[model samples]
Target: MKKPGRFLAPIVIAGITVGFLASAYKFVFSKSESSKQTTSQPQDSSNTSSSSKNSN
Candidate 1:
């Protein structure tokens, strides 16, 4: 029983670590992609606004 518990402990710890890393990577990747989209769209909008103001 004690030997089984010791073997199980490392497996459980490894699984938890992998899950945590995967979630963290996903969170960071999504945030960067969203930032890229927002950044690109804002530049276009800012240009349009500036052009409209000049036209007026």
Candidate 2:
């Protein structure tokens, strides 16, 4: 029987490269989102209190 061609190594390498790039992109966006959430959360809370007090 003929042996299977040895193409697996390059395919595995390409898969690993794509996986890392995808992870990096996901990490960047998630970190940005978390920072954005942290920054905006305080503003909303403070606005709510101000509007409540102003109604008195």
Of the candidates shown, which would achieve the greatest lDDT relative to the real structure?
Answer: 1
Q: How far is candidate 2 from the true structure (C-alpha RMSD, Å)?
A: 2.8
Candidate 1: residue pairs that collide: none
Q: Tell me the alpha-carbon RMSD of every candidate.
A: 1.9, 2.8
Candidate 2 lDDT at 11 equals: 91
User: What shift in Å separates residue 42 of candidate 1 from its native position after superposition?
Assistant: 2.0
User: Tens digit of lDDT per residue, candidate 2, span 1-56?
Assistant: 75565678789889999999999999999999999999999999999999999998
lDDT per prediction? 0.95, 0.93
Query: For residue 49, what is the lDDT in candidate 2?
Result: 94
Residue 14: error of model 2 in Å? 0.4
How well does model 2 score by local distance difference test? 0.93
TM-score of each: 0.77, 0.62
